[model samples]
Target chain A: MLLEVYAQTELRSRSQQHGGIAACLSLVLLLLVVSPSLAFAQDQAVAIHLIDMAQDSELSITAASLADGWYDESEDSRVSGYELSDGTPVKFADWYHTDWPDTRVDLLTQFGDDFGLLWGFSTGERGEKYTIDPSLRVGFVAQAHPAANSILSLTVRAVAWGNLNEQTCEGDYGEIGGVQTVNCRLAATFLPPEETLQYLAHAEPNRLHISLSYSASF
Target chain B: MTLRLKYLVTAAVAALALLGGASSSIAQTTSPVLRSWMSPDIADAWTQGYKGQKTTITIVDDFTSSSKFTGNLGTGSLLYRHGEWTRLEASMIAPLATIKSQSFYSGTTVPLAAGLNVLNLSYGMYARGTYSLSQLGWSAQESSIINYAKNGRAVIVKAAGNDGIAIGSVNAAGNKDFLNLALVGAPSALFVGALTRNGTVANPASLASYSNKAGTNTAVQSHFLVVGVESSKTGLAGTSFAAPIISGYASILGSKFTTATPTQITNQLLNTARKDTLLNYNAATYGMGEASLSRALAPLTIR
Candidate 1:
């Protein structure tokens, strides 16, 4: 296996060039200067403001975080130990979360202590299908100093996932009953509903995500 | 080298060795289930003098660097290494075919033997992240092999990794199998996956837990195949073991189609793969379906 060959060459080169943690920190600092907004929480209820600045007189970053995250998706349980039509308990092999090391850098810039903007990106981990999913997010952030000890924020962002592996889960077809039918039972997996649903999900026409989040912190 | 690659390859090799204890003695004494999966109706093919007499198979893998590794193909005390096992299996399937050996780590280009060359690559080349063919830095050896695949100079059979992910997908360690990308649209190449056991419509086989699938890529699915590795029964596991079966089939098919180009031989095996032999056979998961020597040989000539 040439596993070692690539490990020694491409990965090593990329590592050297990126300077790992140092490079990420530098990029975060640079973004903090020009980017905008207090961080809006992902689900909107409460935001963990990593960097909070209260001075309205100075231009500063309200939230800046660099996370090296591990992303992994578990296999559908149906394929794990489901019973066949004849009661044969079968478990298709599971190799989930085997390649999900990821990096995310998010920066929020505060303008005059009341308004902010969020800029973030994730070097998406390889999904179960083995494709890298790097994504970019751009959003508007609005925050108010409700009290000396409290902060409230509203955020709206659009995220676009990279289109790297376009053929990740394409449905295959064969002529059945003189008509081209999804050969889902054979080409992908033998499981019925699960396989069908799997193909349909991958065939989804949209890869963009739009979210509106509001956060409060004291 | 990343710890993940080492761990994966090592883990797979260790698992294969531990599962079946595929010693030389065990390898020589294949169980009935394994024999059937290795080549369906192989005896018939042998009787017809299509036992790979005119074919040459080049097995490129990691071999022992010691002088103990000789040119002798005769059954001796075989080492319990991966390359040794693959070479033994390939020869057992096509005993009359001339087999050549090369070490992937040697950094030398894999040589193509004259006349019906079947290159059995039971391993893959991997790199971190997804890279287009243009972005990947191909070594001399890889370039040669990719050129052979692209130009239809030989039938390249590659094991579609044991990560249980889709072919060309990055493994959990964040590395992609660039070899899969390199051969995606090649004129004559195969990505062999392993079935847990031999499959038939009446007794359909499921994929081995560790075998990579063809995924949704039409080009990849077109060149992918599944065969029973029967690890529990045979003690030999992994797509590494599944690949030799196809390599041997290619050799035998080459013997029958003496004048066929590598592309024809590849298409013959792929076009004749038995979907009925697989469980819910679809191109996404099973690719072209289970490879059947009996079916692949049924045709007199292929385009």
Candidate 2:
């Protein structure tokens, strides 16, 4: 198609050569008008996103409070089995208070800001669940960017362990004993680790979880 | 990187760190029982498809027993940690188990018959000096409890009694820490004691300072068990509260081990408990170890 158009232009130019300067002006205008659109039509846009890609992913932040008491220090020595006497639980001059927050981040590979493959990891000290296996999550992520900067993320987990392993959840599992027929469940806090209920297992220890508010940038 | 971009990255990292300690302050109280402190994982029992469907749990305490929800319904308030209160806690555990209320001090009785019945006795007679079951003469109401002990169909879960006193001797804490004298000899009873939590930490589950433990002399300790029950609702701590959780667990076990007799259910729950979690894990203090619904429900061999 381009060759045909060029040949036609050449013929027209040859015919209009007699008009000289006027013809030259016409040719310049014609060439100017046709080149850009033609070039554009033939070009394939290969968007290369080195960081925070749009189709690849959107930046998201998640804050989940861990399971209550999963990290709690038993109150007083007697209650925790440290002290048998009702004598008040002796507090160390610096009794390290029990507390820690759970948070994660998801970074996409695309800059389009619309959506992309999710990749993120969680950061927090492991709780009792670690007794069985290292329960920290790191890996590929799935996210939906519903707002300008907010990303709604499914649970953050290392890609090594597919998305379905229940142990990937953050919380303590009681030491298994006997025939292992039953497991009792106890919920100490709200899901997603809201401020009021800091003790909740932010991620489902036995299931997948959806979480929020990841801010994406460069 | 642009200066602005650097600032943005720094801010993001800072925000994440801020979120780590962002949980609002809760005047956290203690309870080995609150689903919060100890991860008993009782919810696993439900997944095993047991919700105490065919099980019945009876609460025997100091108040009068009545069907209606009047204050007459055995200390009507859930705060009493007695009848109604116990029913409330048991519901938290079993959710679907049948709740039967009776009063020992009031001399009232709820007729006991067939089916998987687990009685939780949170109250005990204060009359001093242990009495052998054969030599004792309790009112038929009390004797009926003895009858429950004799009846193999029912599981009796009584508090080791929380006078902080010992049954046959004083404890290391020098408290009168002993099991209740009146209940010292019930053959079929599993005396409940309050465990603080899984005691790899501060206190063992055995004698919660305020809870009574069976002394060495009676060997009644062999028939006791411990459970965590720091009432999140009311900081109320005692074996009185502990007994009901076991009662609820017994009912849940009944739901699964349908044909198992009450004695079998009782023994299975005690035998399969997870005591390794407790510090000093003594039999006298923790009894048949801590009441573990999950361990009891475990299959004989790996499934």
Candidate 3:
């Protein structure tokens, strides 16, 4: 039997107001490495995630809730805390964190187990004004036996996301020699886009990842 | 007639024509014509797209002389008058805010709307000074407004009357604005007084000649705010005009701070008022000081 694991950490910098894009990411990165064994041969492998830890400094979640009316109090169990954004405190509803499993299989059964394919998609996380479509990874893998019990694999994956097209187009006119001409121009959205890693984690449409992994039987 | 008498007659006719011409000049302009007098801070807020969206301002004032006009939404129901002018002024300040007109002549009671609400009371209830709040026999409207103010349910912007006396004091006309008396201790209520013009350090502004000053009462002093009326520029005058400006300001603040309570919004404005803009600034004279929209918007967080 063989076992494998993979994890990624993203750090974002911008904190936005409510109804605005909010992408909060952690800075710490932890990776667990597996040592290869040279005892017996292995057939199939399975992987599971241990933990995903992220930190947010700008916004702190609170447990107090305001009532439904102008300034009424609410007695709802579903409401966990308050979402304090920009300066307004709103009720935080249905807060959760989810992790989906990643799957891969051999595509070339007629040739050998050395060639495989990978495809996976996950749900998007929300921010102030923007919703982050995490990542959709799809690619191929190459496998080889480095030892009697250990197997090594090389994978090349294309990661893509659905980001907002914040470039809005507006019509304009100019007068030239008593004649009018219509010209369309693209404008920036409410919040300006940044080039930080946090912005990339939320707004980046696609990227390429090439990774190498090795696994062995216990 | 003598030559001197003829000269005097000609001068009298000239004076009458000049006075008529000035009246015509003012009449040519529409009511609440203070568009040019709007502060640059308001424009800046607009540029940032904070024009009081998702907020409602209820103008409770004299819409018509008829007792039948009671905030009815039917066609041709609202006749333009004092209430209409106040509504226009408030709408001009916060163009995106939803405005509801209610005539105080019919009934004093008003229904509160959902979300952030700003109540503009440009007109006050007057009575003899010997009477207390309990003895004033406030109608359901006054009671409701006072309750909202005391409980921080909504922002209540009341016009500091044009009597040129201290707030809650009996005027020379032997009458007292009981509304001011009832609202003295309210948490989110604001008494808006008029200034002669926009004040700055270089050209500090004074309270309008006709505006009521903040009295010795600490509660009234804490809730008072003065804004430029600029009647000379707008061809409109009075604390009634001043109240709508604050109402609009409260709406814009609501747009920015979507989840803030009416009390929070009110406190934000009062806390950020500019003292340097008022001439001889004092709590008894200027109260919190001139309402500064720019300074109010500059804060990242407000309690």
Overall lDDT per candidate, in order of appearance? 0.57, 0.46, 0.57
Candidate 3 vs. true structure, TM-score: 0.52
User: What lDDT, from 0 to 1, does candidate 3 have?
Assistant: 0.57
DockQ of all predictions against the true structure, Cα-based: 0.01, 0.01, 0.03
Considering the two chains of model 3, state its CAPRI-style docking category: incorrect
lDDT of 3 by residue, B106-166 (tens): 4456788888999998876665565565654555676788899999999999998887899
Which window of ten consecutive residues has the lowest lDDT sum in model 1 chain B?
Answer: B23-32
Better of 1 and 2 by lDDT: 1
After TM-score superposition, the amount by which residue A192's alpha carbon in candidate 3 deviates from its true location, in angstroms, is 15
Docking class of 1: incorrect
* DockQ result, candidate 3: 0.03
Q: TM-score of each candidate?
A: 0.50, 0.47, 0.52
TM-score ranking from best candidate downward: 3, 1, 2
Question: Candidate 2 A-chain TM?
Answer: 0.25
Weakest 10 consecutive residues of candidate 2 chain B by summed lDDT: B23-32
Interface RMSD, candidate 3?
18.4
- Write model 3 residue lDDT over A121-156, tens digit each, in one string: 434444332234445657666778889878787878
